[model samples]
Target: MKDKKIERPIFPKKAIITAGMPYGNKDLHFGHVGGVFVHADTFARFLRDRIGNENVIFVSGTDCYGSPISASYLKLVEEGKYEGSIEEYVREYHEKQKEVLEKYEMSMNLYAASALDRAGEIHKGVSEEIFNKLYDNGYLAKASSPQFYDPDFKVFLNGRQVVGKCPIEGCSSDKGYADECDLGHQYMPDELIDPKSILSGKTPELRKVTNWYFKLEEYNNTLAERVDYLRANSNLRKNLLNTIEESLKPPVIFVKRKQLEGITDLEEKLPKHRTIDEPKKPSITFVFESLEDRDIARGVFDEVGVRFRTGKTLVPFRLSGNVEWGIPVPDKEELKALTFWVWPESLWAPISFTKTYLETIGKNPDQWTEWWHSEDSKVYQFIGEDNVYFYGIAEMAMFMALEGIKAGDKIDWDKINLPHLIANSHLLFMNKKASSSGAVKPPMARELLEYYTPEQLRMHFLSLGLSKGSVSFMPQVFMEEKDKQGPDTVLKDGNLLTNVFNRLVRSCFYTAQKHFNGTIPVGEISDSIMEESKEAILTYERHMYNHEFHSLIYVLDSYIRNMNKYWVNNMRVADTSDDNALRKQVLIDAFHAVRTVTTLIHPIAPKSCEKVREYLNVNENLWNWEYIFEPVYKFIVDQTMHKLKFLEPRVDFFEKHQSQISF
Candidate 1:
């Protein structure tokens, strides 16, 4: 396979971090935090730890284009300067996100996007280049089409910006964008009655307009193959695979062209009616009754592999010249009419910023090529379910094309080497509370980070994630559920961070106090704690590698709890006078176990882990697995007894009670 593993990278070992493009239209909620940024941050930190920092690079940015942005731009135009322009608007949000994440102690190598560099040329150039390619390939069309034109506003209401009557049977809320109805019925534009532009407040005029499209339908087969590839390889969640399969299946265009009455030819004025059209040059062309009927006609043509009699190829229309708002056609206007074109997929601004940082620091642009182009790069994009279309499909198509692979066409489906990894998370509802309006559940990353330590939050989510497709924000459920039963458990309110912190403190305290007291001499870690420590370290390595974060969380918690348990159970009953050295060795063993657990947990919470490293007087570098075990063993054997205090684990019952009741 072209994508078969390469010799594991020897230099700048390829790792790429992509946070899903955030639309600048609305303020971000918590689910956004958990799904994209938090996940991306985790992976970045993991890779950074796996390979030295110089080799791993993280990239993320904001999306600031297309209809959503244009609408916002127009809205701002009316108000004479938006609090921020579209570019500025997206930049602000990305900055706010960075601020929040930094508070949580996220560090990334690159944050690339427009704010970091005037990407106007890159954006325009990429879109133009794509358009030129499709156009030259005969995938563009210049036919006049009836779009919802708002004459009052002197602009077209791109399908998304229009809102109207609720379409679900007996429902009363507005049918805005056609993503989904409150009743869960996916609706089309025609389904909306009394449809009006949110901008002009006027009934739209169905006016003939010209636009571009990236013959997505042309790539149906390739897309299906990709989906099958993902399904076969289990590259995506099962539900996500199903969604792509359903969406990428050839768009069944049943709409047919309406036949005209008493009209035909270029010389005659076009039909006054907006919905109908006549062929300017005709003979071989026959008009069908309606778009749906025309689709039936097209299907027949497709089945038979119809060829044009006029020697003009019927290139599948891929790109469009839609001028409502977007990157403009960089080519000559006359040539554009004859070409199929599409704007390049936009990335968020922070990613562009990161790109600039890379360049400014004297890193060659080719540094990015290693990750973007290499088969071994193993690109994983973390995003929410809402963004599957763009991130999952559209972006993949662009990259495939750039890599000289033809998407949507058949060669060998199995041979098509696209990005090997795609990790998408679903919405994490705020609290355990379900809302009546069916509003998306918010994420808990930001809020949880405020009160609890980051390690707790990371473990909580990882435990919750546990290889499942959907994760809920039922913090209480996460907190209470455990893989093992114990009377004195450590996890609390899905907030087990403090528990980890206390365990570290106790481990250090026990190790030091034993040395000072001249109790059981600290000779070597007892076989019991050593075995347990190995299990904890091994469990972390296995779960994290498999992306089984949630499962790892349970094991990690159990490891800490058991280590503490080992001490409580043994220390109270030990014969301290008989072999003072051996008695202290037990405490030393417990400390060693704590050290291993804390180091393993560091990927989730670096600062807390650092504190543990600092107190032990161990260099931070020893936290890596290759050293953690050996050092712990050495430390166990080297110590006499040490001075420290083992504080009882604190459970904030008042806070736990309030959290339980909040939902």
Candidate 2:
């Protein structure tokens, strides 16, 4: 009868958490930290407390080798802005990224780069192993896709070297590249319209380029089936599901119905297809059985002079490219000079990081299989919505294909260990897409630390409901004062800690010092207080299990403010009447609430929470969930001898930034 409440959500025995890797071309921006890293770090920290700290492994790193990095390096070197090699350039930025992450107190097991340090050596082997597994399983294919080539520059253009318009129907991407848009839409290089070479300011031509590709189109049905499973069982973001579902559609092209009238025997002229007629719409969809058939139908459309646009669907995911600065690919037959395309390599970098961390601790690198593939352990990958196509579709399909696939095989997903993707919607800067070189440049991750404490920023970021939709990050310091009237939205969540939660804890300590000689009076917490703590704790556990961070903030706000009210309302009456019994009882209840709040808020505000623990004079065991519902006195081994640290007057556990303080 005492335990009656909502059932608590169960957590995995062991978990691996991965935040999306930031590119080495630049240090992290506000979007990268606020949108992805903070969420991932919060969940990882919560898992350590809910489960054991030893059971959780959180990792992320710098993506050092990619077309984007290469492009950025070339420009910097050519403009006399840099005086180092590409590796040196990447390493420099990687160091900056690591420093900033530490300042933000990101508790990662390892933040290894893809092409530096011991982790890099391990990553190379991991990359080759994954490639060989797919090849041996017959999941890899050799395909010749068109690559952009600039004649004036006399160089083969990587994806970042070409700029063009997207040929996909109804895409609002600001810029498209050789094989994909900035928005993560995939297409062949030939499909890009009016491609211009960034190297020479001249039009680029499409040339045949042979490389290894994953047969992603073949797994459309498999991915669609898995998406259905996720929809039923997982707490996936709707935007993520919608994006993946769009890519699972069969190969199709949209053409205006008026253009179809001129062709004689249209059914015979086109490759085998079914016309999906939409009577009210101007364009009709021609769904093809295979990607090959769709390409053939494209040639026929060109001959008939009918303009058409391709729809979003599963395309062959490229595994290797001709880029010089990349993870070296294992040579296949005649393809010797190819390096791994960054997207494919980065997808498995976390695996390398896991193995690297294991080996450092004197465990066998092969031990990673138990962490990654065992049912007892689960991997939670946190990514931004922009990567839904890669992580959700291409990366997931590739993972399944690694499990010894044949030309035709139905994968029993129950046996395979697939990571649960936690995709967040974009964190827009002032309601605009965040870009480093674009209009309305956003503050870097480090720059924000100058204005606000790390804890303040962390709380505000977790309060953003990015799981539902895109949210604007409008820091008033960056905007005109006229644009906003009330207090800044960024300060709302932090105030709960700096004001409400802080005052509650300080009152408990000062009362204990004055009345009980700095020792907690051993007594039972009131029935109402116990039930409230249980409700708050159980609700927090459920939300953490689902990765519902914003909801967790709301739960804490309500709990902390109410606890403050209870203390203020009762303690004032006790002090006025000189009722020592009532005052001691109220202290017991308020101290219980303080213990509960500190433990609950530890994941989001670790430094401040640890300060509370230090003043309480407790060991690390106070943060453990083993005795989550117990009173604070139960945690002290010898309560009679224990005394909390003496607190000075006006001591603040959660502090505000000096920039916000007036002299």
Candidate 3:
């Protein structure tokens, strides 16, 4: 088939940009880059290049709520700085989050929701509105529950403050839950003997408080419907469906000896050894005549590291012994003593950050509601799978509790249901750089930025992000691959990372200094050849449009690689240094190829590309194939006189990292 030249269109007008909200509990790391931000920026930049700059807008922020931040706050209170106002506490963390994000070049247009910002008030108002809607619809109610309160601390205790022995027999940890032990033994908090509050080191008093609960059960059907719809079309939807299905199954019920009919069977059963083969051997029948003898069963099961549940109420219980933290319920006296509960919210630094983000931009409080509560907008949440429940489900419920009075006046809860995108990327653990919950290791994106250009990073993620699969941010693998090809390749023979970057640098260097005359100059171009390169550029654009980002990279890489190959194969002394016409043709073709590559790569590494563009002395706005193939590209080609640096091949680059990196 004859190679046909194609024309490329100018660009688009308007574009939307968004990145995943960061969680306040952990510091940012490389996994975040390979997983979220880099890809977001890549896509955003592409849109900016295609459409006008003013037409594109990207907005995102941190997720500063839920149990984790709340837990962090309680820890602060224990540290004895809990006396300040709530606003003071919220401010401190907001600043910290800003510092972290700013370091990574992850500049977003908005900040995450906070409890103290105008965004917080908006959130609170929306939450209240949603609650009121549900209430009027009979889907919310207040219920009284008996909870442990530490009188010594002068505070009501949530379940977490009560600590006790593991109900599981020989497992022997003080950390057991009411339903399950650390060893997986099942028991109840009520059955905990001599339970004490870890906070004050004293026995807790049982007190009753009225707590509000949204009728989640009522929306279970609605949630299930959305779940089914998502399962049909989305990858994450199917995984959640399986979990919900498993949760809906029948539960095992265990009964204790005290509930038995006046017969002591403790002596009838002999203590048994631990063996899966003889699960019911040695007559545990005496200690557990019926399932009701949960103490004996729980003890024996605890010894064996097994768990069972109560079948009666369809509830699962564990024997956990946690201390300090969680929202406290108000007592009957307090209900009458105060108009409202003056209880505090989270005091963690991130909780304070919401106001920091809003105030940083100097936006009015009402403005935040425009994005968060608007029904016309669709929310797409990108996060790791580990954060799905908190950022996705809990936040949705919280949002529902905060919707407005009327549908248009407030955030629409129904519109924001389970239908939102929970783009949970998979894990990419590193040996030296694996920053799970400890040590502020460098983010994968930052390290990668040092080695690979944005285009390379973008391509790698889109390749692995093939519908929610995990992608590692390891740099050694790519570096090592370049090393195996030897020293002459893009990467040096010894240092893989440096070599790979050098190759990208060479690409820019070659484009900047095309001539050996010390200055780049314009050359006349053939319309036919210019038109041929334009077709290739058009093909690249189409690939991006389809969201086939990997393919797009493949197309661009091949074009540039072949263009380099063409330079090497044809640069045979130019037949006596001055055969003017032939030399000019060679330069014109090289210019066209390099110019095309520069335009294509501008979005991925805008800063680096800008440098190359400056060196080439060309206007970036006129970067489309149409103008790029014009006399300007030839003019820049003619003025360059510096020695050209050949782009080294990729094969030799991998050998450099063979020893330092392992998968």
Tell me the TM-score of each prediction against the true structure.
0.72, 0.98, 0.57
Best by lDDT: 2
lDDT tens readout by residue for model 1, 1-663:
233442322222566666765554444455555556666677677667666666566766545555666666666777887665566766676676656666656676654443224444454554566556755765544555455777876876664667666443334344444223332223333435567777777777667665554444455567677777667764356766765555553222212233222334422221221222334533234333333343444445444444211111112333443544455564545534322221234532333444455666787643655655565555566666545655566656655665556654555654444553445555445334222224544433456544455545555555556246666655433344563345222135234555443644554465455455422234567676777676666666666565566677778778777776766666656654545455476666766776676667677777766665555544546554446566444433234443222323442211232333345
Query: TM-score: which candidate is best?
Result: 2
Query: What TM-score quantifies how close candidate 1 is to the native fold?
Result: 0.72
Candidate 2 residue 179 C-alpha distance from true site, Å: 0.9
The residue pairs found clashing in candidate 2 are none
Better of 2 and 3 by TM-score: 2
Estimate the TM-score for candidate 2.
0.98
How do the residues 388-458 of candidate 3 rate in per-residue lDDT, one tens digit apiece?
43334334443443442221233323455232433434545443325444353555344444554444444
List the global CA lDDT of all models.
Answer: 0.52, 0.89, 0.46
Off by over 4 Å in 2: 1-5, 405-408
